[model samples]
Target: MTELLWYGLIINERTVVNMKKKYFLLALLLLVLVFSLTGCVPGDGANNEEHLAGFFWGIWHGWIAPISLIIGIFKDNIRIYEINNIGWWYDLGFYIAVISGFGGLSLSRRRKK
Candidate 1:
């Protein structure tokens, strides 16, 4: 009787473990699909736009840089920095947003008294 009970417990544990693995795989697949689709967005070198990306675009890109980096890893054309940008102003805005976005998170952390 004890042997049967032990066997049942072991099977239950294995089932639970398999379920967890399946869930993990499902989540991973979803993440890959999302990033892969996002990677397809217009990017790389320069597009046919009449106007290049400016300071606002730089800020937007900088904000989503981390996501772009992940997408870039999977897709060849995705880039973190915009190639079609207005020189110094774009760079300045990118830096500002990047610094503030990341740095602000650190600054906003509450310290325990």
Candidate 2:
């Protein structure tokens, strides 16, 4: 682009749009490559082992579950509950987290006019 300006060549709007599309595609390709290279789950038999990640961890992770879901799309071993859990307790924490995180907004008190 600078070279074009230096050469006194006019850049068209179509050219700018094409450049943006190329950059978007490049970034998407890079992300796919990166996510494909990493296995998010640990190799210590996480599928069979349940180490009780506990309530606090469950709450924290659940708060960020949407992010984990996106990452899980590329990795095979990663999951919301597969990373060591205390079964229903973890679920309880997750439910609590999700409810508090989103439901609290809906439950907000309104001031009387």
Candidate 3:
């Protein structure tokens, strides 16, 4: 659809409008994906720093787990989970975020509403 528009091939106004809407939706979705997958702020290699990435950070990282995982494959520095977390609470937040981000979405889509 977009290819046709790019090549100056779309002749009908209706087709162009429809394609524009589709492209807009596609762009919006891409934007959401990019933002959702945003990783944490990089830290220095210092060993004695306080780990602020607790529950909130865990939720954010977990929500973007899928994207982070993909990026992790290419980059070594980028990690899905914090190396030094506070404890089980961090794990709790990550699991909650994962379930909400993935499973919750699936559940929502299943309803007609």
Per-structure clash totals for the candidates: 0, 0, 0
lDDT tens digits, residue span 32-56, model 3: 8686556352221221246456787
Best by lDDT: 1
Off by over 4 Å in 1: 1-50
Clashing pairs in 2: none
Looking at model 2, residue 58 earns an lDDT score of 65
Candidate 2 per-residue C-alpha lDDT over 44-104 given as tens digits, one digit per residue, 9 for 90 to 100: 2433454556677567666766656666687665665545677787778878987897788
**Relative to the unseen true structure, what is the Cα RMSD of model 2?**
8.2
Q: How many backbone clashes does candidate 1 have?
A: 0
lDDT agreement of model 1 with the native: 0.76
Q: For candidate 1, lDDT tens digit of each residue in 1-113? A: 12225545644566767889999999999998777645433385444356788888778778778878887889887888888777899899888889998999999999999
Q: TM-score for each prediction? A: 0.58, 0.48, 0.62
